[model samples]
Target: MSALAGVALEHPVMNAAGTCKSVEEVDSFARSAVAAIVVGSITRQPRTGNTGNVYWPGRVYSINALGLPNRGLAYYGEHLPGMVERAHEAGKPLIVSVAGFDVGEYQEIAEVVADAGVDLVELNLACPNVWDGGAQKRIACFDPGQTAAICTAVGDALLARAGGDQAGRVPYGVKISPFSDPAALAELAAVLAELAGRPGGPRFVTAVNTFPNALVVDADHRPVVDVELAGMSGPALKPVGLGQVRQLRRLLPDTVDIVGVGGVGEGRDVAEYLRAGAAAVQAATAFWNRGEDPSVFGSILASWIDAGGIDPVDSAIR
Candidate 1:
């Protein structure tokens, strides 16, 4: 067992947001061995997501722009209460990933998730696939100022829903894109530290959204997917994810937990994340490669336990 953001988890492994988007997918996670149910990087409106050859998977790496396809708020909202109950019955907390077009939408969607009684919320600030005209939409985590604004808004909303005490309220975190530049990473961490000092601050940080704008081409010299570029994941991304987690662990106080993500394909990967000081870890490409089957988690988790994945100072399992 493990704990993330003060919520008890049966294990440290849970599916990443885009890995499971539908009510059925989320419910499958609830019934599976996963420690939590992560639903949506959902938007205020229904999204068909990016279509037409949007995904391509490689042996140890995959790249494609998914465009954050989701059923929108109304569909998930109506089904959320039931999803939460199912998760609770199975001894797991429901964590919703909120993605919005603007700061106000983040607050609004988060309020609905908190009201539905989710145990945790993660604001997705690093989606690199949403295209507007020819360029991608602004990624929230890149700018410290905007990141602070979004976090402040969402925090205030969640705190208010809890009647001003975060103790009984839904805790929150941010899923940030991977950083290749030390100075940039430090800048964001400083902003996050400042936020962490506040009452409505982040309870945890999920590191390393896929490396953005990666384009894969086949032997035929054509783009692997329909889009020119997409986020990259699989084994190639693990190192970057680990580096981000390690740095965040050192930079952020222990009061703010860290959840590691990237290129995690097996039990050893889980152990690696723990060694890097991740309270928990999430998976996407690994799960996708396993045919969206929950058993993949069981296998990977079994491997982790065999590898002595738990660490007193690093792993969240005490």
Candidate 2:
């Protein structure tokens, strides 16, 4: 059941990886709706993240510039055990979203958390600037070959960490960044297909992390953040997210599972991602705007599923 490939979540609605904080931070709000709460990205090393305001909400949308600040493996080991216990008390699964500078670091963290007792581990390949050489987000490694190599390296490390036969005991999946070309996506999907065929590799892929960075100038014509551009996410990115998921579904073999995430704000959004062929779905901005209240979207999705509602399908694409 730990195989993320096609495992049914306790609930269809899940909190997006970085959007929600620690269990204690949103416990009351998450009690009702979220079937699972993924703690923020934890790295191999401790990070204080970026300084300055990380969240800037607008009329119908919000902008976030928070650098990925985490307690690292040492702190996560101490903090997450308690969080997982609490989520279990509420009958919710706890997925730990983790990032590492490279493959070795990723496996190291996965092994540590698996030993500590996490239900699933989400390998965040889209984290902003956590890699070496000061590479920024999206631009970290645009070459398809590089992406495939990175994934395969990480996937292999995870398999090794899980020790093959016990791979089923710990689920592993990667959240992919949106790369424009279909050929590039197909190439990356091919790599995943190869790994999926291997002894122990990832079973699922989460598509299109935040949108490519934006250049927004204030009244004084000054740009925000220390970077030249920042990624955009929210309702505005919905269509782009849909397209990426739809394409990945088309490119990936049917055997490979996909988790659709990005610009999801409601049951309808989850339904759309499912329609695009995601085995599971997640959101960040929605939870940010609606708070952690589970019923905010979970009940709505559960109710829709209870009814003989329209099922999203790839056949509908034409």
Candidate 3:
């Protein structure tokens, strides 16, 4: 078993936010072998998302510009309690993903979701496709100041709702942008380190939300997606994600859980992240390419571990 903060997970695998977006998907996760289920990114108001082609699957990678479509926090406020109860009955924890246009919006949405008994709240600060009032806003994870402000506000709100006891507060984490530059990653790590020093700050950091925007064109010389740039996922992102996990492991204290994400498709990939010092790992494209049954990958990991194919400190050598 792996534990993040005080919550124990049966396994270290779970679905990434936005991969499981519906009641049917939630029910499916409840019955699956994944350790937990993270609901789609939710906003204060419902969103219709972007138009035109939104997803493109490739041999090595996939690109998407889904634009954070969701049914709004009000809908979740009413339904998530029951969903949480059902997930608990299945012996799984239900995590909710919250996204907002600004810090206040993040806090508001997080406060509401916290009251619904969610086991964890993931603040999505690195969505690359969000457009506000017809203009693309800067991804929050790229801005250390903004990231710190949003995390502080949301953490304080959750703590207040928990009545001043840090233990009673629901653990939360940040989904940050991928950084290939060492200096930039160092800056971001400093921000997270500061948050970790806070009395009731984030307990975990989900490394590498998605790589920077990418563009794909078709034979007719037109963009495949309506948007000029989309987020990249799948096998192409594994190396980058692995590097981010390794950097975070070296920089952040062990108290802050690191969730390695991006491009993981098999048990070997999950083991790679674990060896990089991630407490857990998450995958979206793999689930989309492979299927909803998480055990397909979990079983492979189990078999590999039993065979001593993975060593926590040096998985490559093993």
Residue lDDT tens for model 2, 186-296: 777777777667665666777767765666666888775555455667777777778888987887777677777777766677778778877767777766666535455
Residue 84 Cα positional deviation in candidate 2, in Å, after optimal superposition = 2.1
**What's model 2's lDDT at 177?**
75
**Ranked by lDDT, top first:** 1, 3, 2
Could you tell which candidate, 1 or 3, scores higher by TM-score?
Answer: 1
- In the predicted model 2, the residue pairs found to clash are 29-292, 33-294, 213-230, 275-312
TM-scores, each model vs. reference: 0.95, 0.84, 0.93
Candidate 1, residues 1-318, lDDT tens digits: the string is 578988987678888888778778866887677888788889888888787888787987888688988888998789888888888988888899999878999999999988888899999999999965666798889999999999999999888878998687789999999998989999999999999899999999999898999988889999878877889988889999999999999999889999999987788898889889998999888887877787787787777766776443555443
Residue 29 displacement in candidate 1 (angstroms) = 1.4
TM-score of 3: 0.93
- Give lDDT tens digits, candidate 3, residues 84-104: 988899998999989999999
lDDT of each: 0.86, 0.66, 0.84
Off by over 4 Å in 1: 133-135, 310-318
